[model samples]
Target: MRLTLASYGLLTGIVLVVVVPFLVAVSYRAEQRQPDLSPERIIAASQGAFAPAIPPAEDLAVLELAAEQGIALAQNNLAVILLRTRDSRNHDRADRLLEAAAAQGLVQARYNIAYRIPYRFNTDPALVERQIDLLQRNVAADDIHSMALLAARLGFENRERFVEDRQAEQLALLQNAAATGDPDYLFLHGAELVDRVRNMPPSDHSPARLVVMELALEAFLASFEQGEPRAAQRISAMIAERNVGALTDRLAAMGLPTSDLEWLDMAGQAGLAYADCHYARKVLGDLWPDDLMTEPLYRISAGIVQDALTHPPERRQRALDLAEACATPPQIPEFRPRAFGHTALYLAKHRGGWPAIGDSRGQADVMLGVIAALGVFGPVDREKAAFHFDRAVRVHDYRGGVGFLDRLD
Candidate 1:
């Protein structure tokens, strides 16, 4: 049994050659394999919750791995991320992932793929038709997102016949999704309700039509409550319509409680330009007090006049010229002194004023006259300013102010 040194060395060399490679291969494989690849683990890691002692993988890499392992959610999520890149290669991969996920009966994946191929851009009619078919299936399954998307795209793909089919189907889809409490859906639903009312037969006296109109109003109110700015404007328009048209009696008969003023206040608070401007006009309208000296408008005008008086003559004249330009009605609406003055005039012209100056421009003329007489924007011109005030007193029946004749002329 004695072995020679050469034979022993040859046996050791053979063992090293085989065993070392096998050990190295096993270590490499172990390093490459993940400790956990479950859907939860994949999602957690993607969201930055890493397992202890495991090397962190990029979110996309983890999702890709889980997707390849046939996790439908991972596939759908990965495809969503890929689709956002807008790269053609990524889009192709995303399409395949979406297809795979959809085939596994994921409702969102079906909608995602259908939404991805917008018929507007996709020239392939067959492909567009397929997407429509998929969307219709999802809609039938009561997928709210699919209903909204299909409602939008239904007529966009096909001919006039498809467009004609939109009225009932689109309205139904919008109405169904409206209760989902999504602001956009509520707005669309309100708009559809309005359209239905507009198309009602004129001679039809169905209480149901009034109910539908009331529903339209309700939808707009709900949308505004949900913080949609456009809804505020619509409500304002409705209020105006009620005030101007004979529909006021009709709508009021329905006991439709309109929050016209309340909605205007909210719209003003939310910084809507038109509503805010209207609010400013309302405030200014109430500003005609017994003592003009106590008014904020009077004080602001006095300060400007004081500032101009302190300047040297030439500089005062230049500043006065600029101030005069500023005093004119601004091309753009805003809440400034000029705006207050202009709005006073606008209200006096379009809406009747206090009973003393009823249906006349007297109140506005007096404001303008006083502004000019005090040199709020230019040199004090008693003669020029008195013209408007005196004319209002004589012609327009304005006796609110004593003409400030001594102060003016």
Candidate 2:
């Protein structure tokens, strides 16, 4: 019981070291167990702080804490999670939370509210009007996505009410959105233009209408350049709609002469795969010179062809002769193999013979089968036709399936 002052101090120091560490560890564990509702923590968690590895439950705890304290971002995020849960009570709560966030002028929350109003909430006329008001506000704020969605909804879905009744306003909204050069908006604007062109009466087909259609095509090309995947399909459709004469006229209007291959070359260089195929076809038809021709030769041939059109019969033969002498065998165009293969199969089926250009073994066999079956290049030989058809079928040519079925019958 008789301890010296030095002994007492040593005992107290030892107790403090052990107790201090235990108390700190306990406090840290308690803090970790509870959700942190600090503004920084709420903002980070709202932005997916837990990320891919953590479960939703951990994220929900932190979000709930912040949302209960009226944090708009947290409210919006928690609303989204609740919406995904599919619980009826949570659905109502989520809608209320979204409305609360939107009332705070959160753009994303407004977008979500506008999107969900017609579908998730009952589509009352008042609610629809409210959603439209929010979308208009967002559009006025230069939110491009809202502009696109609103345009589609009003101009396409509720045309009679929102678009036809206010045509000029709707058009302005669509044009403004497209003017941003955003790929999605550009595609949508192009599509709307296509619809307008399609609906125009024959009597309405003036030069102005033609210019509008050309602008639509340019929009599609621009959208394709901006990485819109579906834009290529639209360009192909537009090309398919016009004949060579119409295309030539359009090119001439643009100050690009149709006598040369410049238009096709430009399109091909712009990543239009079908343009290369079309150019290859034109070369085979002698409508355009082969790519192997020297630039001077090409120009000379083009000039001769152009002159032949205006020349009298006596002079025309000489022009034709000069052009023919300048011509060379066509080379396979880059990016044309797949389209060429398909074209070869199409010619064999419809024209009764394959084009001498565009050679592929599978397509060649299909062509041979068709020729043999139809007596195109020789006497009909069903057995030989059947043999080629079988080979084509084995190679997964779906067209061969039709021939194989015919042979079996």
Q: Scored by CA lDDT, what does every candidate get? A: 0.58, 0.56
State the lDDT of candidate 2 residue by residue for 121-240, as single tens digits: 335667767777888898878876667666654643443453355545655666787799977677777777877777888667577777767778777667767866445555555555
Tens digit of per-residue lDDT, candidate 1, span 1-409: 3568889988989889998899999999998885566666655544321212222456667787878988877777666655544379987997898889889977777777776665574457776777777778888898766777777666453523433566678888888888887766777777667667767877766777767766777777687777876566566556655322334454467664344544555664554544543432332232152545444555746654555465456644433333233223335443211100110010000010111213224554555466667666568777766775676577556654453645333
Off by over 4 Å in 2: 1-40, 47-55, 85-90, 119-124, 156-159, 162-165, 243-409
Clashing pairs in 2: none
Q: Which window of 10 residues has the lowest lDDT sum in candidate 1?
A: 343-352
Query: Candidate 1: lDDT of 380?
Result: 71
Clashes of 1: 0
Model 2, CA-based lDDT: 0.56
For this target, which candidate reaches the highest lDDT against the unseen true structure? 1
